[model samples]
Target: MYETYTTVIGTVVSDPRHRQTSTGEPVISFRVACNSRRIDKRTQEWIDGPTLYLTVSCWRRLLTGVSQAVAKGRPVIAHGQIKTNEYVTADGERRADLEMTATAVGLDLSRCVVSFEGAPGREPSVAGTTTRPVGSEVEGAGADAQTPTAA
Candidate 1:
């Protein structure tokens, strides 16, 4: 069977959590919130639509880029497959949630700060990308943080 999906652009509502898989691969998880405002004809004023909360997961090569470029409340654009994930509780109960296995993620630097996260041993420079370090806030980023250096 085939399923339909939609793309969403918004801000990161939470910090990205990094974890290592049992096999030792890196994965990062974070949430993004997309809100929309619409005018109610009867009220003649803008009202908030349902906020979309997506759990985005990034792995392998993209992991580090996501960690460095994205942060809480930072605008971003994410595109990927969307699906509901189910899990079991300790009491044997069932739980369900939505997630997006992000194939592409980047900062919406239209009018926000750009930063680079430096992981241990792996310097930001080695990535061949010029960055201001994770905590350093650079205002008015053009796009995709600073231009990435050639591989």
Candidate 2:
């Protein structure tokens, strides 16, 4: 079997909708919008490229993490297998949508600061942890926030 995999960096455009299938398996789905920007050499100005919207689905084990970490308006990075779904609207309009079955999804740290969450059913602590200021944070970021560096 052949599958197309891709990574998308974008903002979560809707709240994740979660439900259990008839067979009792858990699943979650959400929408993401990716807007790109580039600098044009001719005018020396930034240009906004067309935005790509996609629906993302995650199954079973991924549901918990996504439920805890993902939400509307949050920046997220999703890696998954992609497919194009074509359909006809009620008014006889044709449409195509990009959909992905995610293998991995997480916060986009480049755009925001976040606290490390403890695993499900566990207490969060910073015992014996090392931390350092991230020099790449946007100017005017709060002084007290710092990302954990891998040991």
Candidate 3:
């Protein structure tokens, strides 16, 4: 059988819930709401379209980074395997939930600006020369060595 993969770009609708599995593995879950907007040809105005709510789950090493970087109302992009959860309630109604085991979660650059802080064990590249830790001043570059502020 072929597995399905998908990418979702949306606003974080809920705070990330981080927890440890029974085996001591870290995990995080969060909700995202994706809404479509279109321009009306007649009025030349933008109108809101339908919205899709999806649950995103991050596991292991990905969990900690996602939990720290994402927050409620923040725009994010998630991509991974897709799964549909089905369940029945006491009322005898069946409902389906769209979920993804996110392999990657990142801020949606189109919506907002972001500063890239170097991760641990990773080398920071400045002008393709020397490697330095995040927030360290680069030698030889006078005033331009400063970190650029996000607009």
Candidate 4:
């Protein structure tokens, strides 16, 4: 089976919701809104573009950290398998929503600062040396649970 993957860079529009799947697996879900803004030379003002909103779901290991790190209006970058969820509404109208089951979600560093905190009992990397490939900590704590302090 083919799966579609996408990365979204945007602001979290809602608080993360912690819920369980029918099978009792923990899942964290939130909404992200992506938009662009540019300064107009003529008016010397900012011009905002249309916004795209997608519901993002984090599962298993991803649940703990995301539930702690993000809140409404926080910037984040989420990458995952993309799908369109279609269902009938209570009003008897059919609706479709864009959703992503996130494989990874993190703060948008370009918009805010981040401080790295290793999980307990993990050794720190030696200066001027690499212990592992960047992003190899997927199996460990991906978001580090601790809220980042902006500089």
Each prediction's TM-score versus the true structure: 0.68, 0.74, 0.74, 0.75
Expressed as tens digits, the lDDT of each residue in 101-141 for candidate 4 is: 99999877667645444446885322211122233343444
Q: State which candidate has the highest lDDT.
A: 2
- Runs in model 4 lying further than 4 Å from the true structure: 119-151
Pairs of colliding residues, candidate 4: none
- Rank all candidate structures by their TM-score, best first, as comma-separated numbers: 4, 3, 2, 1
What is the alpha-carbon lDDT of model 2 when measured against the actual structure?
A: 0.80
Off by over 4 Å in 2: 117-151
Q: What is the C-alpha RMSD of each candidate to the true structure, in Å?
A: 7.4, 6.5, 7.4, 9.0
lDDT of 2 at 99: 97
Model 3, CA-based lDDT: 0.76
> Candidate 3 — worst ten consecutive residues by lDDT sum?
124-133
> Which candidate would rank higher by lDDT, 2 or 3?
2
- Between candidates 1 and 3, the one scoring higher on TM-score is 3
Order the candidates by lDDT, highest first — what do you get? 2, 3, 4, 1
lDDT of the candidates, in the order given: 0.73, 0.80, 0.76, 0.76
